[model samples]
Target: MNLFTDFESRIKDILETLESVREKRSELDFGRVNVEPPRDPSHGDVATNAAMVLAKPLGMNPRALAELIVEKLKQDPEVTDVSVAGPGFINVRLSVSYWQKLLSGMARAGVDYGRSAVGGGRKVNVEYVSANPTGPMHVGHCRGAVVGDALANLLAFSGYEVTKEYYINDAGSQIDVLARSAFLRYRQALGEEIGEIPPGLYPGDYLVPVGEALADEFGTSLRLMPEDKWMPLVKDRTIDAMMAMIREDLAALNVNHDVFFSERTLHANGAAAIRTAINDLTFKGHVYKGTLPPPKGQLPEDWEDREQTLFRSTEVGDDIDRPLIKSDGSYTYFAADVAYFKDKFDRGFDEMIYVLGADHGGYVKRLEALARAVSGGSSKLTVLLCQLVKLFRDGEPVKMSKRSGDFVTLRDVVDEVGRDPVRFMMIYRKNSEPLDFDFAKVTEQSKDNPVFYVQYAHARCRSVFRQAADAFPDLNLESVDLASAVLGQITDPTELQLVAKLAEYPRVIEAAALAQEPHRIAFYLYDLAAAFHAHWNKGKENPELRFVNDKNRELSTARLGLVHAVASVLKSGLSITGTSAPEEMR
Candidate 1:
């Protein structure tokens, strides 16, 4: 159970019973009432601002209302003491018995303890890592991939029906360049002495295998076809090969998408989807024929002063109305985006989230406006912009990879430092904040390294159980119920503090999911790890604080229950972050 949520319910119930509250019941709004852990642990177990928020509406003094609420709260059997602080805030100390019982529940629930129903089964589509299908995924796509995957995991854990998606940008000019690059490789495979790649072509050696595959499939036949005839065949094959490589790279980092929507689909059948979407907008008076003023600074190459088909996006939320079709009657890239959004809305997604790189920040408002215009404000849209990750090695900048031609591939990072570190460090910072990922620091076994520290905490928890097994060979160390029965012996303040941290997991998950910030989970996990490590260090100074005591089987078992709860929460959070909780660390 969520302790803060439980206490908030209890406090609101207490407020309802007050005579003053009954008089103003019809006018009262309890939405602002919430209970959270006290900012200073020394203050109490839980803190609330119920009096401060409700007193004005009730026409009563804040401190006077707090005292009244305190009296009713004092009657709660679970609450050991209740007090008023700072004008109107209320602090309530819970009994050790209450914490002990909560610990029992936590141990019984295991890793599933933090799973929540806050999302109410809302259908959320999280689309991320839509990197162009022209090449392997580089480090630039890595951060967004992990952020989006972790976010999907977080949302699912918090009870959302989450669909992880990848949007393939295969309909652009970049794909044409890829086909031309692959054709060169195919020629080279046939013993043609092709020189250095041209300025505009992809130069990576990763396409050598694709070239070989093309030779195996088409032999010398493809070389005889004209450019237009060969272009489509080569483009399709190259996209398939590149996506296969991209998927393999993503898999190496444990990222998998439920949907891989192709941009070409929107362009298929004479742009059927794009036409339908534009028609829908036209019927709604959101489509118009207009010309856009030249953009500030250097004009874009495609800018035309002549009139064209446009979407009245500004009427919804965009900064300016956007072009749908260019002067040449070709649909713009934004047209494909509109169709993509309509496709998602038609599929009955209640919310859509786009995980894009920081460079795509300009798309945020327009995408938000599209949701309003396309869904008629029925669906919500959110854009999470992940900042660039600067790579470093021992205080020096990392050089580019020849495998990727210019940048470090996602596989390069994963293969060198490992996937867990890559995934964890990618999420350790807020997505909107630039992250400096150092190869030397993340893999270090010290507490300064968050992933290692958090993983080590889980490993230590397992070690405790192993130690307990050897200390009491006859004891059923595997029985959560058995350990839970003896939790009353775990009365130390530090032990209870760990349980208090565990109790915050559900709250953290709900808050992070609502904020759409998975970094909060990383921050919370790190804090919990620090608290656990601190307590473990205490055992060295005081023998009584040891988790597995040979002289006291009952206390040891009780502590083991506490350890189980910590491990369960750590594993749960780590799983959400797409990092493994190892059984042991070498």
Candidate 2:
């Protein structure tokens, strides 16, 4: 169980027993009162500001209220000591028995120890890596893909029903260009030279197979048809081919989506979905026919000076009103976005998250406004803009991949450095911060390589169990009942510190899921690995602190339980990050 959550409930119960607190119970906001690990571990096990937040509401001096809370807290059998520090902060030291029991619970839970129901089974839609189906996915899309996939995994682990989604931009003008590019390759496949790839069309050799497929299917018939007839067929075929390539690239990195929502579906049949969404917004008084003033900076390509259908986005949360339709009566790109979000809302999603690149920062406020307008302020919308990732090799900037024509394909990076390093290093830093992924650094089997280090910790944990098995052949390591194990023998300060780190796993999962930041998981795993490694090193210097004690079989078994707990946590966390926790480091 979550110790902080357990104490938070217990502390609130204690506050409710107070006559002063009961008098203002209706006005008191107990939500502000929370328990967390103390800033200084020496102070106590858990710290809370219960008295500080409840003091004024209860109409008592802060310290006086603290003393009252402390008195009630001391009555808890699990609490060994309670103290008030610096105004009204309460610190409670849990008994050693409590920690030992907690460790037993952790061991029994195994890899599922940190799984929580904090999300309450809410349906969350995470849309990421919706790259245009014109070419292979580049490294520019890698960060958001990993971040979004990990976030979805984190939310699911935290008990949320999450749907991982990808929006295919197949209905845009870019698709027409892609069709033309493929048609050129189709001609080349049919024996025409087709010398230079035009400047405007995609030049990647990746599309050559699509051309050959088209030629094999339709042969010279496509060339004889009118532009309108052939263009539609060509677009469909090329989009499918490109999406297939994209899927392979994503799979190589272990990223997959539950739904591949097509933009073409929204634009089909006279743009029915778009028109229906506009009418819904219009009925809500969120749509109007108005011209927009030229934006201060570079005017967007879709921005029109003439009167047009507009979304009154400013009425919700956007900085300026957004255009929904062009002067030619055709719907703008934002119109499709409005329809897409309405579709997600109609799907019964409680929350929608869009993981876009940093360049799309401008879309954040407008998307938030769209959610408010479309969902009528019921559904929550979040846009996480992942900053760019720069690739380097041994301190030198890595060059672009020639296979992708201009940029490094996600598959190229994954194939070169392995998927674990790519996935782990991509999220090693905050999504909002720039990440420098160095090829040489991540592959190194050193402490500096976080993925390797964390994996090594798990491998080391397994190694300890192997040593225990060899040292004591009679010991049943597999069926060692951790609940009845001699856990009290694990009294070393460093060993207890490792247990504390494991205790933070559930808290980390809940916090990261709530914040929609999976980088926190990566950061926490690295810290946990460092703690395990540090403890392992200490054992190297002091034989008595080692996990396997040949002369002390009971103590060795207890320590093995601790090692199993560490491995379980490491394996669980790595699974969430889409990385593997190896049993033995190669």
Candidate 3:
């Protein structure tokens, strides 16, 4: 199934023969060797520079070493030819039967063709879209949601036991403000003339429905209660309503979390979980009383010389020790976060990934230090910083303002441009880089939009199938038999070139999974799509090259197998990223 692996194993056998003939005068170093597809097909199927890396160490000329390796590899029937190219590089041309056999394996494997066991059953917890429960999810949240969800899917496909988690910030002052805003709407729902919303309160029109619902349920009974009694009631109601809205926004983007850990639930009934986390740190000698020098560069305006309870984070690789408790004896945000991560470790996750906004750039190192310090360096944690997304409409940037309480929700963009374009563009680049989401350009059914281009290619293949069915009524999809046919019949240059891309699927999935970069899948799909489109368009110029030939049923059925494999892989990859592979373009 994996042609690259087959070539690598054959090359390793050659290395073994080279080792047997050596006199043991020097250490044989093949550690840095790598076998991969050459950038230019003219070079060969797989190329390696092992001889160059080993020449100086083994005290042999690189070209001589390469010649020895090639002589040894001539014994492998799988390697049709091995050449010493350039100074010491080895280029290997695998037998054409290797590729044809691979296509057969792919057809039999179906969607599971590229699944990997790279994770080896390691447990990983991925936390994403931990947006505050004060408002609905906006477009800024879309990128992180998709990246994190896709990352989880990628890891799971690679055999990791993965957990998709969302951290709810329900215990902060922001939630308090949300409650106050909801109380204002409750009064308005009661027909009270609560004028324009104050500057500090949420003013979104969505809150109006929440207010009406509250009035309908409580019947104005909370009006006479004191602020303290009503605060908790209002806070609970508002958070319940807001979290519901946030969930709907995420669903529109095709995201769902396995766990929704609420911050308030951590301290339910004043159970003192944050204190327990600090006390556990105390046993490890990380707790201390210290006055941090005013944060270098820009000090907070209220920075004072007050001694506070601090954690010796610098010992674990932080810039400096950080305050665990504020001057008023309340746990800071860092303390609660520490407790949450501890819970993750306790739940048996061997590795963890946190997806956060670029504004949280400073939080990465310190949070990592906390996780390491708590887990005694036994747990591995990685923080993926998602840079800001600048949304564009008609080539103009959309600005978000908290004052109007009307932001561009994820639902808004998905409803306007659509889900596939949004998912494709979000992961089309590194997550650390800022993205430009232009609504006008993404919806265009042109090559300019990558989503449409890939989907169009898949749809194009289906068109070929429909046309082939017309010319031949008995084409059996149940037995997509390409193995029995002489693959040499696919002699068109365009057909052979497209097969080269299909050959890369297994290796491509492995690399993308290993780097924890789902965006590479987006890039690979586009490349495959481009190759397919080129082959499709070339048929117009040469009628014999068309997938369906009225005169030759044998040639058409053989090409059908490759088309089926292409469409299947495209569908699986798109599904992993929560994108649909439509069967038609128009």
Candidate 4:
């Protein structure tokens, strides 16, 4: 259950009662309110901006509204005290019994404790890692893959019906390069010399297999055919091989998409989604043929004034209206993307998310505007920008260049550091910020690595359980029957603090999900780990304060209950971000 949501429902009831008594019909835009723990623990258990958010809209003084809400909260027995602090921010102090109930709820629901129905099972399409399906996915694609997959996981847990998708750029000049490159490999497989790949062609050794397969299939027949005749067969087979390679790379990081849409298929075989998108936009007055202006700073020598088909995205929110068709009468990359989003809206998904490289930042506003136009402002599309990744080994930079095709692949990183560390480190920084992935430090068993520290917290908790088995032979770590045996036996300040942190789990999940900031989860896990470590260290300082006191079975059970809750949150969070929580850290 979502404790914060339950509290919000109750607050709404009280507010409705007040409105009735006062004879008012005004709505309080409470949807924009936020509830979270204060940065300073001394302030209180939770802070809310209800008063500040509603004061101006409701035509009331901020301090006055805060005081009214404080009085309303104070009447509830669950909330022991409520105070207004710092210009109408409300701080709430709940009874320890409220925290105890949280642990009971966690134990009852297990891994499902933090899930909320905020999304109401609405469909959301997430398109990401739509890298050119021409070669192996390099390190540049890894960050977007992690962010998109983790976001899909988070949105699903928050009650969304999420569909992960990849858009293959198969119909483009790049694929023509792939076709010609494969033809060269096909000749090479036939013992011909195609020395030092031409500068305009793909040079990766991966095309060798495609060439060999072609020789096996045609047995010298294709060699006699015209270039155009062989282009289709070579292109399709090359795309198939490239996509298979990309899927395997994604599989290495445990990322899987629900669907794969091809760009070339958009206007091929008498079924063109792109043409349909343009027609729909044209019918809606969002598209037109217009002359474009020359560049303000520098006009190219080959520049000629011409008319072009454009989308009026600037009126909606784009900085400049965008061209959908190039001068050569071919669809621009933006046109394919518009069709992709329109397809998502057509598939009954009202929500769409695009995880794009940071270099594509300029496209965010236009893409969202297009989605708005196509779906008549009903589709809410969000674009997450994944910044560059800087790779370092022993504090030295590891250079990467994909065009040269000698860069590090996703598999290389995962194979070197394993999945948990790679996933955690990739998400430790906000997706819009560049990440410094130091190879030397990630694998080191030190507190500097946040992944290992969080895992160590979980592993230490398990060690305590193992030791408990030695002290209390009858105690079952997994026993729900022990609930009665553990109630109200916990007393240490450190233990109580840890329980309160666990009580904040549902709130943390709700906030993090709404913020679309998975880095917050990483930070929260670190704080939770700190709390668990603080209490564990206290046990070493005071042997009588230890989890296993031979004289008191009640205290042992209570402390174990707290330990179980800590482990539960760590496991839940790690699972959310596709990280693993090991029972032992060896």
Measured by TM-score, the strongest candidate is 1
The order of the candidates by TM-score, greatest first, is: 1, 2, 3, 4
Per-residue C-alpha lDDT of model 4 across residues 379-401, encoded as one tens digit per residue: 89899999999899999997764
TM-score of each: 0.98, 0.98, 0.95, 0.92
Superposed by TM-score, candidate 1 places the C-alpha of residue 410 at a distance from the truth, in angstroms, of 0.5
lDDT for model 3, please.
Answer: 0.83
**Candidate maximizing lDDT:** 1
Per-residue error for 446 in candidate 4, Å, reads: 0.9
Prediction 4 global C-alpha lDDT: 0.81
lDDT of 1 at 254: 97
Stretches off by above 4 angstroms in model 1 are 480-483
What TM-score number comes out for model 4? Answer: 0.92
Ten consecutive residues with minimal summed lDDT in candidate 1?
478-487
Please state the error at residue 394 of candidate 4 in Å: 1.2
User: How far in Å is the alpha carbon of 478 misplaced in model 4?
Assistant: 3.8
Q: Across residues 68-160, which tens digit of lDDT does each residue of candidate 2 receive?
A: 989988888989999999999999998777888888889889999999999999999999999999999999899999999999999999999
In model 2, residue pairs whose N, Cα or C atoms come closer than 3 Å (at least 3 residues apart or on different chains), thus clashing, are none
Off by over 4 Å in 2: none
Which consecutive 10 residues in model 2 have the weakest lDDT in total?
A: 482-491
Q: Residue-wise lDDT of candidate 1 within 492-531, one digit each (tens)?
A: 9998899899889999999999999999999999999999
